[model samples]
Target: MLPAGLHWIERWLPGFTQRAQDLGAVLSGTATSITAFDGRLQAATHDDRHVLLMASRPFLEARIRERVTALPNVRVVRARAAGLVVREDEVRGVRHADGVVEADFVVDAMGRSSRLAEWLGDAGLEKPRLERLRNPINYATALFERPTPAADLDVAAAIAVYAQGLGATGLSVASLNAIEDDQWLVLVMGYGQERPGRTLAEFRAACSELPGVFAQAASGAPTRDIATYHQGESRRRDFTGLRHFPARLVGVGDSVASFNPAYGQGMSSAALQASCLSAYLTSGPDLSVPAEGFFDLQQVVVDAAWSVSTGGDTERLEAAAGIEPPEEVRRQRQVLRQLLEAGLVDPFVARALNDISYMLRHPAAMADPALLERAAAATSATPH
Candidate 1:
């Protein structure tokens, strides 16, 4: 998880950070840095101001479940959600095989394939417009056992190698992370027809094309077979702009928006949305009305994540399809390219870019006039 998500978790569940560390979550020190390579030169961005926590999804989810079930007001129900129980333009409860479990409010956390829209249509409510970015991204992940006496490892906690300018290379992106249990989690991603194969040899061959750290990490004994997944698109359901919606019903996580998992923004985005819900509830809004205020707050979080994840994909996909984007879109892409070029050599620009990438700051932070001016100057001054 990113620092932003961890911050909210620590706030809501006191002592979560310490507990997670104790339970084998690898928390990077403040000195941790993320190294990025763009097929040619490399740059390292220091996370001196924030630390990221690297833990497997199961490990993190188990910890969350342990804490949440301990709450007196919450209960663990082992049942499938069949549908929503709506009455008088409000979500009154959930329908399951056994019966309906009523609630004053309902949160749809059923993930990317959430049936909330279908249920809403059944309830005579308008469905939110779904926006999709068709970028066929395929990725594979493999786990490796870390070498004994961990000090022998040469790589940092995180490394990202991009295939931006590499000509005709099947690979698009590759990364490695130092996780708990003295293991390394390596992932290789490709776009469209470039699929990362699901074999140890193929995984290592792909890593060999990447930087040295990836090769070194892949040399370790394989702990598991490579697992692969394909995402056809990044999607978001526009609930904020909806004119007709049910009251006391809200969506979070992938139910609201699902981005390219490569960006690692899903969990962090959901946590921020949960924080929005908390803020909305504390404000004592009338439950009889639609949760427009909550949606407004959630939209900001979604838009930031969506922009960060989709900006580059949109540009690349459009170019590959032989389609030119609008003038404004082209200009925005040019500005971002300048900022990235400047970030390679300018610490200030690097920090600002890293902050937005990690969701520590909003995407709007990139528009700071002073930052733009500095980036432009740095881009001009730096030797190509």
Candidate 2:
């Protein structure tokens, strides 16, 4: 369904991706958006990351439960988190309906609906400041399967929204992913467009503009009715920036930052966050008041993901706002656009870009003097 960084899998959860129905390489494309032509340069896959065909949500949840339940030190409690139990400025533990349970530290991984802000306020502490990019995007996803393979490429797919002027045009990108069980996960994305095709007919029309394989595979059999999901501006709660934070308390996953789901970084990013925590526990000094250093390290992790996800969505964000972005944003975007165009034609550039996409390589890899020199040269020589 998606490719994951090998670092997370090998270090944290070995054989996690093995539960997938199969393993496949991801294939992607970039298009001109409006014309619906597949003539743009094809994207290259990276060897470091792996494309996994995972089971559906329910099955994946069951697998997670099974593995976690077997751990001798783990206890699975299905209780609501009433709030935090703070003794003065220190976080003692978590409070539930039954009573109080204490711990050396507590990680609030309650996801996007995390009640951390409420708990912080209740404990007489200011909540973390939130930084947001209000693109107000929406997506409609549907599952369509075929009795047989009719697609030219049976991997993953992506469409890049074209820019008509200095800023992005008010259109969006769309995609269809080849999932396990011979099914395709169809997604129709809009920047501020909000409405994606809802009914089967509408969903088909949405797919009509996507790659042909999406339509052909989707036409065969109906796995389930079309489904829809909506997400507003991507948010990063600057927990690291909070001045009134307590020790022995931290957050992970969406609690720290909720990215645009379209990027598919939610699960993997959380895993990486957990990995960071592990590193801190093993090497860092004892936890005390103002773990600002740990939060600083976490910010580094979040910054990597934010750059990739937000950078990719530049067109949509600019388009939705209908304004020219800042000078720095424009300059970086133009450079990235050049690299993208160059990647379509050059394998090396493609590899570098793909690595950047998976967050396996720092974004600075795109700025390698040699690579940029080569890409600029390649762009000039080629016809636009």
Candidate 3:
């Protein structure tokens, strides 16, 4: 079961499913690669037992935009940015190609290509510090129709396969409504070590190279057009770590930190950050501590998401150097691996894993010795 509070994933998934159905579309495909800790290829394909949980990227983005724009206080703008304007160590506003937009407070929500820092530098404000993720990843995806028999099957229970070094990761997911119209969603993700092909024939060939489940799914589908998105590396700016920041401005969403899209934490992180900002803003004006409080809250969300993404990145042998997760994190991940492995076999465990994976529960809660002991007991009791 999903968590009680509404999450971006839940909200976006339904909107995407509805949009696809409206357009006579079915499932969307996503194949994400991973670097296993054991230094081996771990690729997954579309025909796997678990293809129902993934949705199309375009639909997902559209749904999120729809929800964000509906907020009374939120306004959406479509224009390229020119730069930021500041004076006397305080933020004045932002300048875009269309015109200058000034407000009592200004927020930079731009993604990885944020020009806020450069603008800060130009305005003589302190430059923000940057930390990049250890891995570089890319993605390609398409939609497909599921086989009649697979329709209505559980797609959320699907598992992904990660190939360590063979041109990114190969995996497939079946969206919530993909089976309603007999379709599925598939994505191929490229990791630091592996890069997947982009063209249709090449993508099919790459999927064929994966495990039987993925290959069968790719080979079985009557596919839609293909698309690609390049979002490499996870980046975080140390705004909280800075001693001085402009009082009249704040940065949120990808402007503050961006995770590898493969980790699927970007949207969730942004939601949490926005929630923090809302709370800070609702508390009324406090020029004395608004910026610091905002960053501190954002760091909590970023650190939680980064811990998981970076942990996985470090496992990839060809990952960028200079990032070595602490031993404690490594050990904790071992326990998580066991849970995931168990989840692959037990439906109950899968639900538990899903709950934690979606950030419905604290990561530390999963580490309870009782849960580990229960998992061990359950594993031993099962037939070989």
Q: Which has the greatest lDDT? A: 1
> Each candidate: what lDDT?
0.83, 0.67, 0.59
- Model 3, which residues run further than 4 Å from truth? 1-55, 63-78, 145-157, 163-183, 205-217, 220-225, 228-232, 318-330, 345-349, 379-384
| TM-score of each predicted structure versus truth | 0.95, 0.86, 0.74
Q: Which lDDT tens digits does candidate 1 get at residues 49-149?
A: 46677777888898888999999999878899999888888889999999999999999999999998998888789998899999999889998887743
The model with the greater lDDT, 1 or 3, is: 1
lDDT of 3 by residue, 37-81 (tens): 222222333322221233455654665578667878887677787
What lDDT does model 1 reach?
A: 0.83
Q: Cα RMSD to native, each candidate?
A: 1.9, 4.2, 6.1
lDDT of 3: 0.59
Give the candidate order by descending lDDT. 1, 2, 3
TM-score winner, 1 or 2: 1
Per-residue error (Å), model 1, residue 309: 0.7
Q: Please list all clashing residue pairs in model 2, or write none if there are none.
A: none
Better of 1 and 3 by TM-score: 1
